[model samples]
Target chain A: MPYQAVPCRVLSLTGGKRDNDLILPINSSLSVTLHQDQLKTTTTAAASRDFTEDRLWLNGEEADMGHPRLQACLREVQRLAHKRRGGSAEDAGPLSLSYKIHVATENNFPTAAGLASSAAGYACLVSALARLYGRDSLALQVAPETHWPELRVLVMVVSGEKKPVGSTAGMQTSVDTSPLLKHRAEVVVPERLELMMRHIRERDFEGFGQLTMRDSNQFHATCLDTFPPIFYLNDTSRHIIALAHRFNAHHGRTKVAYTFDAGPNAVIFTLADTVAEFVEVVKRSFPPATNGDPFLRGLPVGSASLPEELLAAVVMEPVPGAIRYILHTQPGPGPQLLDDPSQHLLGADGLPRCSA
Target chain B: MPYQAVPCRVLSLTGGKRDNDLILPINSSLSVTLHQDQLKTTTTAAASRDFTEDRLWLNGEEADMGHPRLQACLREVQRLAHKRRGGSAEDAGPLSLSYKIHVATENNFPTAAGLASSAAGYACLVSALARLYGRDSLALQVAPETHWPELRVLVMVVSGEKKPVGSTAGMQTSVDTSPLLKHRAEVVVPERLELMMRHIRERDFEGFGQLTMRDSNQFHATCLDTFPPIFYLNDTSRHIIALAHRFNAHHGRTKVAYTFDAGPNAVIFTLADTVAEFVEVVKRSFPPATNGDPFLRGLPVGSASLPEELLAAVVMEPVPGAIRYILHTQPGPGPQLLDDPSQHLLGADGLPRCSA
Candidate 1:
């Protein structure tokens, strides 16, 4: 099976219905694509007949193009472009191995924070290159950021002190070592993906939440199943899971569902109706011990009515400041169009607008 | 398939090779018989012509005789005792249900402490009853406690503060809800059990330790697989697991292996040669902050060399005094012979010697 190059597969091989019921990726790329405007990785790419060689840079520093994944991406994309306009490339004959490109990438968030920064980086590169090549095809698609206003993502930023284990490398190790993962990918994902799609179509937050939580759990289970296991969910992340269950079960339905990426940070899914209350539970469960606030980032629904039942059932002492902060976000479009010149990473001169 | 439900299965569904490869109860009685001398449970039984009905008092409180498991144990033993020499001059006429017995049982250990206190209690009752009925057939067996000299078990006492989830109930829930558990019992256990037996016979510490740890992990994995899953391992327990792997990997051998019971307490298995060093690692990883002693009970292998590699590899801050005290014990013989008359729970009057 073709592996999901998307970064969400790092945390869990299965990606629940983010398309919200249309179609699910069979390999389980249950990734929550964040809005790239604020946490943008601006990649500047220029392809010229004059260029002699290909080069790349990440966050202003030149990065090696020797990695096989990079080579594969470059090869596949260039191959497609060459095939499309071989004879007429603005008087540039047969586009194969003729043009050289320089790529520059940057990240607004910390690399390896398990925030899917790689996802953003690769996406920006793909977008910028697509624009640079001046080619528009089904291979690259983007929508406006305000497409899905109801869907929200709250990132419970955890301590990202450990060295980042790259997504694909971690996934490769899991595939090699984990039997549970094999069963999940082969047996569990297909059925769950279908169900998740249906639930998404119905806009059933409760069903969606449950599917999200279970798939995330199964993913973590596979991680644990890996020999010499990997632990992405720490005490804080575990508490979030427990709290979500307790809160949902107490309410007789899922008000919140949490998904952990490769890092300890939790991406919680909740409708606007319940997001505020879920945030309250988060704050109460993980009180800010630090002088700075612990609520992290989220649309703070004021002191939510934490029911006696939920309060009693969650049964855990707050490990103050376990969660650093929260990042509030809503699902929107993919990579957006740059209307403002200042927002463009590349100038008309075909060089990076910003120092990279 | 019938549950191997000997006491070993009572602790974990996947029974480890506890008896040094002797008779493995394939039915999953993965039970480790505790020595009655050190961990004692006293029971008194009286069979009188005057008693109208069989009654039981547990820890001085009357317990219902209607529970099926309890009734099954009583009925099976009684039927066996009655079959032997019954209807003859040596036995009462027809023997079956002819004698109404009053039984009183007591355990010195705390039941909720995650120690197998109930196992010790039930074994004592069964032994006393077997002796009382004069049933010498292969119905009951006991030997010295120190049978296996090389084996050692250290209990990392965890928080038993939560209400105890009964083992049978927990097992039933797991069986009902966990598909992974079904796969484990039907597929994983048989193969692993054979390997465990082989490992034990070979007296291979590394092999034995690896099997124990894997079985424990699978069992817990099944628990996680359960719907509304049960969590026996807390942060402390998970930390211990990570530490064990890091320690083993750093040393490039399985010097120590950790297994968890139904609760958070970790049962670490290590050979005598490495116990001292493993203990030191445990000490350094989990330093005590309370005025109380940290090394509960073990060969005070006085600060064995905590290798720089292991120390650096297991990246964790000391969660001061996470574990209660550790119980130091080696694989000893079974129940010992009680020679003193005062040691007998029952008096010459066929009644409990104590006031209860």
Candidate 2:
């Protein structure tokens, strides 16, 4: 059996739509492939196996292989592979429909921490499976990661703890109870997506940044509008949002943008030109917990001295250690295969590696 | 000239609508007069006064005499007084339109603390001036205070500091930026107000409490949807909201309801029967900063033991000093004239009393 692994999947700037009705009418998002932070998935398929069942491991823990979504993905892949064979044994050699598959996955960062771990995980899984089965899986690519080279993403990990309410359940409840969710999904999102695409195409940082923040806010607003209401953003998240707004308002332009997923973490978007200054501002507003190690990862941001007026403008009661740390990254390619055998998450024995 | 003082005014369960277009279509609210939390104002009209202009003092400090709203109220009162004289000099006695007015007002509670100070103060001013000028000011009242004797209000002073953004400007921004605000004001408010009124009329605490909380959350949701967004509820405010929801969900009934204005403070409503238990839950969730000098004021609430499961349901990190204090009050009379001269806020010189 041949094994394959894909690294560095994408995380979207916009939230995913789960409502089937809303998804059919209009479902769009602006996404950027992350370079530094990644989720790696390894897949191995055997036409003749000792074990007759498919198996999966996540972060060294064996998870439910019969998970409905996983089953659906596996069924779809096998169906495509069977069709490609066309009843002839010639095309089915090692990639036959009767093969059992073993999969192992792990993330370099925190899982279920609102860092889009599921998105990256699922994308990597499907991509790796497609490669193993010699099947082509079509996925939408609005613009390549290289389209905007100067764009940067800062993942502010406010809390890496698992969110109390999972996105699936939270969004389902929102669809059932929130009156404004329908309006937002049907009316606001489509128009905003068009504008976002335009801003990305034109590289209009200010327009892109403002729209990003507004859409994120409207999403949370709908959550708040839900019955028994949901509060995803905590004090630290709110403070980060306020700081972003103040920093932009002081400069009289949109210098920074912030988007929050289902949890308290914040993902900030800014251009390469303004990243240094904004980092300085963030550092001042949310002082790091310790001075021993670097509080930032990925692309290094040089220190920039902000003007007195600018510093004064964004000044608030600093909430020390509000942000645990930041992962500084930029747009890069989606799901690249690792050519090195040592990089595989699964060992040669068809099980997750001990260090995975 | 005779002086009169109205002791108590009212606070509504719903937020006030300032959008002229929305207000014209549907502007209804259910209010209850608070007995213990009162804003007292004393007014005297001198037919032959030495001073030519109207004078005013609020909380013993001289305020802007030419404030637009105050001026408009004064002009309307004088116009009514002049018309009532029948255009005959003999009909116009000491209570004449040419009289110069002197007004003094004070509140026992903290000013600008989201305690409905402005509402009470303005209502007191209008009621007092109308009596002095022999004019009648018709106000729409759905029900008097005695209508619901069991209904109680608990003012949770999350932070007594003045709100950063006043409700006036905040509503204007919402009208301009938030798409949901228009829908809420026009469609949601009227229907919700009807339901609230029916609940009040039928003494349905469950319905009334649920609608009150929903309306308040939607109001804040609109604020969140605004561009650059408005955050009226801080960490402590959000905690209180969550606690209320958890408590209600635990019992599978709406035992307590919370409503927040344009500030962090929470105004909670519960029936007399549930007030003691809910108060116990609140005390456990938010323990007092100091056990001395009773953390609760207004109507005394007898202690009740909450069940262990109920306590477990509302268990959260106690934010010490998050709430400064609580005011337990009940609905009472709107406004009454105090015949006692000693109760007047003004001295014999027609100025604010030194101790006022």
Candidate 3:
């Protein structure tokens, strides 16, 4: 069986309790899911006939198939598949429930480097699994890509270095130790999620941008409040934040908003109108290192001249190559199956076609 | 009449509501006050019959005499003095309430550089006023300097650059915007202050160090929660924090603690037994740039040998000259009068003795 792999950009992660057994959103959870053309993970999942055991390969290397979350996803997918086929496997044509599964996933971006690479990987893995087993995806989309055409995303790679504290362990420690995390989960997030959803639905960029920046700050605040504390945003990340705030302050409004995950990379959201100028601002603030790889990638941006005053306004010491690169992208369609045989990540030998 | 000058270090700022008028401790407030032989603000006050109007000189420049807080301190002192003399101005000598005052103050460290120089300045001003007016000082002492002789303070000067945001304005904005700050002020501080005082009384190094670190982190957390998000702890400050935590974890208990005010400099608290080793660790972590100022100052630190394992455990890229220098000192009595006439900052001409 062949399947499409879905890679997603998690705009805002708003939830407390994580359910290891289910793929669907809980009642209390609300996340804005969209797709970006760049920074994706491709997973090839198949129901194997000859193999006697379930196997998994991540980025061309063999990984534990018995990982709890992986097991949970596999179990849920199979159960959903069974339920879909009139509560039994007999209704399915050739795919059998007893067949062992083989999965291989490859990420275009750095894995576990806090660029939400895991989100894309997990999403792709589960989507591929669901597709192979004749089950529909249970992921609840807050809004379609068409809902906000002007919205754009910039993935600022401050550091692709592996996160000192990965998200799972960080969140667990935060849940156990942070009082601010408890307050944010129970009291702050619910109302904030509602406002975010409304802002997205109404295409209210100002409200949306402000809330996004504040929520990001508050989330990191809780991380700092954790016992022994967790530091995800390094100096470069903070400089980016200062630049964002300064850029907005210069405009006298929220023209751009920055968010950070479990690592130092910054995900900035802005409108199509503001993107060019803000990109210029970013370039001026964090000049690319000489003789390095290309500084900008993905969707092309128009040339915009930075005003002298605007350049002066964003006061920061330029740290060359602080940002590895800038990935410019926008709201895009979800997973699509590749009909051509050459597009398959796994080859005829049932192994990764290319090493990561 | 001539009066003594004083300077002190604010060990922990535990209360939220600030009084613009009084020098005494508010009912809900509790702070650990200690004096350092270095890093002080010196002030000289005199009741001058020759002067036509009250005047003030700060750091060798003639400053406004009508500043609200200064006027408030003067009025309070005069009222206390009048009351002490049977509520009659006639009972006093030639050094009467009606006489115009001349005052001069100087800070050895950088002013408003988040070293709590303002605290020292204010304490010195009020003490000088009280001494000249024959009124007893009313500042409540939580515990005297002799109580914790081994409790050492290391003022790690990460940057002497004036802070991006000053404490007064920053706190005002935080109070107006940050929900976490409000919660901390109203709900968190009261309980934490009690524990801090208890830790001091019990001489519980573990409890005291842990609480100190957490409170410092929480205060900065609230700062981050403020609108536009105030960022006082820069990269160097965060690196110092990481070093402190790693050092403690290596020992399997709390041996050292770090705190930050509204700037990047770190005020680390540790016991005498741990100071030498920790200073060695700091020197290793943030090695001094060649030809720069001396790395350590103030109280003498004995030689210490760092174990290979301990050095390997605290892994951080040595940020050369990230910390300008470390000022090492300990608890001492506050607000001592300089009886020798030569110590006065103001000469017989009622002007600053030296230009800043």
Candidate 4:
């Protein structure tokens, strides 16, 4: 028997809120899924008569196949699919194949280290494979990619030589030891999630942006509360936060909102109309050094002033060359089916068409 | 009558814990009163009919005498002294001469910027005035300075261009907004204070050291949890913390403890024996730039190696020139009387001797 392989890329554009999911979190949390136009991980899974075990690749390089979470996800999905069909693969007579799977995923967002790049990559892999195999994804229930129309996400990648400790591990430590994290989970996050969902429902950008920034603040505060506390934002990230807030203060409204994850990189949300101005402020405040890499992508922008009004509000003195580049992108669809056979990674033989 | 202004310096060699003291804090906090041999704020005050009003000086310059906290402290102590005599200033006229007082004060620790320098300064003022006017201090009730003879406080002065927003103001914001601070004040500090007091009673240096570091971490965590987030610990303070922790882990015990006040300066505590090695670790981890200011004062610590074990434990890469200098001193005593009249800042003419 041979197994089907599906290739998938980036997923998540506008984040979804998880409110009644108490399995892991004590309260609800909202997160905007990111959609990187060019950054993706192509996952190809196939089972063959000769295949002996599951195999995995990350960034075109083989990675350990025994990761606990991956195994758990795989096991749950297969069990659910088996129940849905209500028959064993052997007895189903062409309904399915039970060969071992070999998955190859190549990532293009390697430079976005410690900022949960794998999250979007894995989301794409699961959703695409579920569609190919005619089964529901066992990991998460999410809305269609087209659900949100106006959201945009820009990732400001700050360069640092040392890799940060994985945020997943850090969060676990905080959960176990930080009293602040406990209070936030039990008391604060539930109400915040409600307010965020309300802003989302009403399409109130101001309310959404304010809630987004505050939620990010609470998350990082939990990180800081951890014993032998964890620090994700560097001086550069602090400068970016100040710049965003000061810009908003200057406008007397929320024109832009900024959030930082496990690393110093900032995810800024703004409208298409305001992106150019905000980007201009970033350039002037933390200018790229001469002979540095390209600092902006997606929409083309020109020089603009960081007006005295905005500059006066910023408390931090920006440090130049702290950021390596900025990936400019807009809100778009989640994972989608590719109609062109040329775009598929799997070949007629059920192996990868392009050699990893 | 002339008020004597005693010099005040480092305030946190011993820490106080808040337990059952719910009026302010239900818990008992142990603090080692710091006696900086050179870091002093001298204040000399004289009361005379010729002097029309109260005046004060700070660092050789005139300072406002009508600060709310100062007035409140002064009024309460004067009231307490009056009640004990059970007579008005007019009834026992010689007991209390009605005269406006003039005062002068100075500080030598400029680089020792943020850690609530004004606390020790004000503490000295209250205690000196209490002695001069024959009253008890209304601010803090504590054992005499002679209570903790073995304690020492070393203030490592880290330099920065901008001063942090005062810690007092930072804490108030945290209290009003940070849920973590509420949890700490109500649930966490009570227990932790008991442990700290026990450690103090038993003279358990290791226990005290661990608790000290943890308490500081909790305080800063609450700071981070505050809205708009207060960041007092810079890259330099972080480096110092890592140096201290890594050194302790290497020695397989807590030989030294570190705490940060509202600012970046590190208040380090260690037995007199461990100071040399700990200072060695600090110097190597954060090497002095060539021909920079004196790296350390007080005890002379020669060059030493950063052992492989200790270096392997530190997570932060050392940042150089972030610190200005280290003021080395052991825990001595609180404010003391300068017996020599020649040391007074106020001269016979009821004006500052140095003509401030």
Candidate 5:
């Protein structure tokens, strides 16, 4: 049998208003690429037909039109489309928006592994919907400006939590709050740091780990020594640091350094040469609370891909889940549209097939 | 007034007894070629004339022989010579051994800065003595080994207040004890360690210090994990390590690590990328414990010479003054005879002239 394909598009959104009426600007956007795959045996035949229909899968299950957030997002997006097309606000006649979205979302790595799978899922869903409605490219290009309120709605939906808790806004605010932020430009010797990074990329873990740990520590320490004393590193983080130091001292220099976010879970950055060594050391030293718990399993390394438009605005924190799985990434260009839209997840009538 | 040239023949005595049992087997001889300028400036006119006549310098204030270890060492050498030649156990006789030693010493840097001035001085002394004696070839051959004992003696003497508390024996024992010592024959690693040593020799301090600290840490750590536990690092050493780790964490990766021996003094090693940063951090973080105290002064860098004949036999530890300063050395040939006996520290009469 010939494999069925779907037509899908992705969009990025940014910026929003808080409940307190303070406008929180979204500095980063989320992207997702949609593709079609054979139906799994676990999925019911009706669910598979639904997938062939609306092309939407919710929470890895069949999509339901009744999901509150989905309903709210779709309504808001249609309202914005109506407004942009100079239509009357009171018209409830479907708003005449066209195109369809097929969504199949999977958290790239293990769930509950301290990776931000939730954020990615929501971001991808909203992005897919926006693309289906033909607003994705335009929305991303003008981002936070051309459609500020719509961007806010998208961000809120993607974040999925009730209170719009900062998201990328917090990162910007932190950078803005830093007195040393200005000095960061001066402290950097690009050539030297580049050489070091190259050396790191070369898998000289002894050398690379030494540098990475030092740099991260310095960066965090500077944050602490800042006027108000911001601490990204908590007790657990410090314990990890201490453990790593002891490990390096015990063994010859190995590649393992701790990077922390606003929360406690640690993101250990290590080089290929010593990654195994690091995993073993961490496994021995900081085993999970439960014997069979997979939350703190071996590190899943990968790259964090962002659109070219968003790259300059992005500032990676010691954020563990602010990032998803660590992408063992190298430099590469942004998304290139595929020639065949059939490779995406949509139906012949250019409408999403109901998966559920 | 003509600058009168003084002839001195340097001779090295090898047979030594520890607790009345022969510990050192004397097989080779050494000679030194000394000019008048090379004589100690503090030597009285009579002592100078005596040095010219006897071709030997007895222990005296001018020679800094007030140091009991230096005195004991010379006496031990003399005693062994008499015993070896006379073949009589009781005779402290008028044993005749002809050799002249020209001595010149200076302290260009601060004496208490923990520089291995003693090692340099002893090495120079040995070199000069070998030249004065007709046994230059043998002295050159065993120069590295010969310096080890004298260097040990100098450490003991200068450090004073001791019964050879920290002896070179512990350090040199590795030569006999290390199982990997024989593997040097089959190794093809381009002697990365040697390249590191060469980097040290070129006074590439940043490179040297980094390697030195790492090697020293490894060396001492190995010692601690040796069959019987040995503690080369003390509390101060731990403090230094903690601080370096902390500092490195704050900055980007700096090539600096700290290593210590039995003493409290620390040797900090850093590379070019991090040398300046390390120095600044050290200066800011570690002010002198006392106003005028010389120890714990900022890092003072030095190099090792490639000893001519026995590079393979000698392993230089990076912890400066760990066993006192290592001779900046490369491998060279063994000792040889000098053409001019007049330039020898020992005159033709073969008697002590100058007080050593």
Candidate 6:
């Protein structure tokens, strides 16, 4: 099966909309690995330039550019690439290397369960484009030479249809001003968070949900008291918080921490070690309707990469379609150059091909 | 001139301490007027079958009953009163009324500033007695009953303490509660809250300090979120809240509101409001403080019951001795007659007072 030629594969990783403005870039590297099955394989070939105008074969048939946001994304990415290479004869020469791209996207989850689709989509598009254009290094570098501008471009492309709903800019500013930033300590999952994470990876939905809800509440509270108040949590958020608190207090601890993007959807983070206990507690505590099914069917636990032989764990998971697919990821280095050409998605002519 | 026992002169009235467990009753009446020099002068005294021993004298000392909370308050008030009423009560009767109460308190303003003293002190005692005596009403209605166990009893005998904290139970509980309670309402000072009651008048301090601070924050918020929050206006309180929000966007409208009890002490409540403008904006726009004066000072205003128009506007001046105070109070009912007089402080002989 050969990969099709598409500009970019937009992965709606988060199930819900995120406040684009809050997603400011930090001095850290971000990485992702795509599975073969996640893509669309096809034989049809179409004209290379003006892909937006052309009815390119998507999953199966010729797909039209129906959504304006999608079109804006395509144009924006192309513009950014041209800018990087230096525009026109007066500008620098063709950016290091260019390529024709192909994309395959899956809904993966249901519509509007308040999970974050924007985060997943943006993260996925950036990942896929980086792979296709061989700009992986630039994409992953923590404090890259082109930081703000590049981050803005990526944000614009990902936010496409959305009118930049205050991406991570404000949040970043707050972090900069935080006095506690100096004392910043990353809390690695002790046995508790770790066990929960493992359970999530194993598709233990109940257990995962319990831990995620609890952790999210604590995280948001911490944010609230940070110097000048930063409220990522609202009244509704608090109601949800109270519900989780009541649930945990009544039953044993279950999957509970909830992480909110600029928007209100909760990204639940659970501990890997206590998956079963967490799941059992959740099932026994919250109503089935609110918590969904007991077996926690269809939940996927994506594994995070770790150096030590720590317990296998899933950093994130799919809560049905409510949440975009979970990215099982861990700390990783910036993007690096690939020695093999076979992995390249583009030909010398800068057009994407099924087999390099 | 020898200070005569102004026949029937009531030195001060005090409703005892109120807390989660105890309610003390203040159901005795007496009438007296202060001379130009602020000395008590009695006009009428009811000759009831109840013995002279049943009468409470200002300087009369009382024995501790081993109740720590009660002991603490009685000791404090008595020490302050000194030997005004003369010797201690000999064999006072069994306390008739028993009150059970619950209290929740917080200051809306800076604690050390002195604005919280009166509000805190009054609320502490009144609430404590309400709990001790099982007086059911809210903070505004402990006195002024019509029939037997009459309002006079409460107003007269209770008014013997040298400097008793003012009570809001009478006013707050009198107002009706309705569904409209949920809707945000404005607190219009139809009239200033500082009107002087013949029995309870105001005093002026040369400058604003503690009272201003407490009223600006604690008292105001208390009133805003009262049993059903009431709103009192203090220009300074509003400005302060507005200023806080100006520096931080996360600050809400609910952050600032002011309320004043019978004394000069005031409190302010703060929260984010849906209005386009915010407390922060107001705070920033305000002029900087000059020298020692605060950027703003909260003035007390509310309706008084007197028929005469001039007296209606009588503003309570900040008394030097009156400290800033704040306490959180909710809706409650008025004082009731205790069915069991076994709790009465006077003995069966209806003469001398019991030990407690």
Every model's TM-score on chain B: 0.80, 0.88, 0.92, 0.85, 0.42, 0.24
Q: For residues B1-356, write the lDDT of model 4, one tens digit per residue.
A: 22332223222221222321221332234566555564666666566678888788776667788976677666665676677667555535333535666767656666236755576566667666676566655435344555555655667888664655665556556666676677777787778767876776676888878878877777777777676677777767767776776677778888878887777778888776766667776766677777746878765555556667666675356677777777777545556677788888778876777763
lDDT of 5 by residue, B1-356 (tens): 00122212212211111222223321221322222222221111111323443222323223444454444444445444555555555644332343222343333232322233333344344434322321121222322323322110001111211211232343334334322211211231124345553653464544544444443443443232221123344433444554565554444443455544433345443443444344434433333234343432222323334333322222212222222221111122222233454433333433323332
- Please give the fraction of native interface contacts (Cα pairs under 8 Å between A and B) kept by each candidate: 0.20, 0.59, 0.61, 0.52, 0.00, 0.00
Give TM per candidate. 0.81, 0.89, 0.92, 0.87, 0.28, 0.34
**Can you tell me the CAPRI class of model 3?**
medium
> CA lDDT, every prediction?
0.62, 0.71, 0.76, 0.64, 0.34, 0.29
Off by over 4 Å in 2: A1-27, A36-48, A79-94, A159-162, A291-293, B1-27, B36-48, B76-100, B159-162, B291-293
lDDT of 2 by residue, A1-356 (tens): 22332233222223334644323222456666677343233443333365577888887788898987688777877777777768575555465566677887777777787666776677677777777777766767667778888888888888434476776666677777777777777677888878887888898888888887888888888888887788888878878888988888898888788888778888888888888898888888889988575688777888899999988889788878877788788877666667677767666777767644
Best by TM-score: 3
Decoy 3 TM-score against native:
0.92
List iRMS (one decimal) for every candidate. Answer: 1.8, 1.0, 1.0, 1.6, 16.3, 14.2
Better of 1 and 6 by TM-score: 1
Off by over 4 Å in 6: A1-47, A50-106, A110-114, A137-258, A262-268, A290-295, A299-356, B1-356
**lDDT score, residue B284, model 6?**
28
Candidates 1 and 6 compared: the better one by DockQ is 1
Residue by residue across A1-356, what tens digits does model 1's lDDT show?
A: 00011222232344222222222332654455565433456666666776677877676676797766666667666666666666455635333345777776667666777777776666566666555555553432222335345777777787535633554556666666665666667677777777876676677787877777767776666666666666666667767777778787878887777887676777887777777777777778878666755454434454568777777777467767777777776654555555566655545654565663
C-alpha lDDT of residue B76 in model 2:
69
The lowest-lDDT stretch of 10 consecutive residues in candidate 4 chain B is B14-23
Model 1 chain B poorest 10 in a row by lDDT:
B1-10
Q: B227-339 in candidate 2: lDDT tens per residue?
A: 87888888788889989989889989998898887778888888888888988777777788884756888888898987788788786777677787788887766566767
lDDT of 6 by residue, B260-301 (tens): 333223233222121113212332233233445332222222
Residue pairs with colliding backbones in model 2 are none
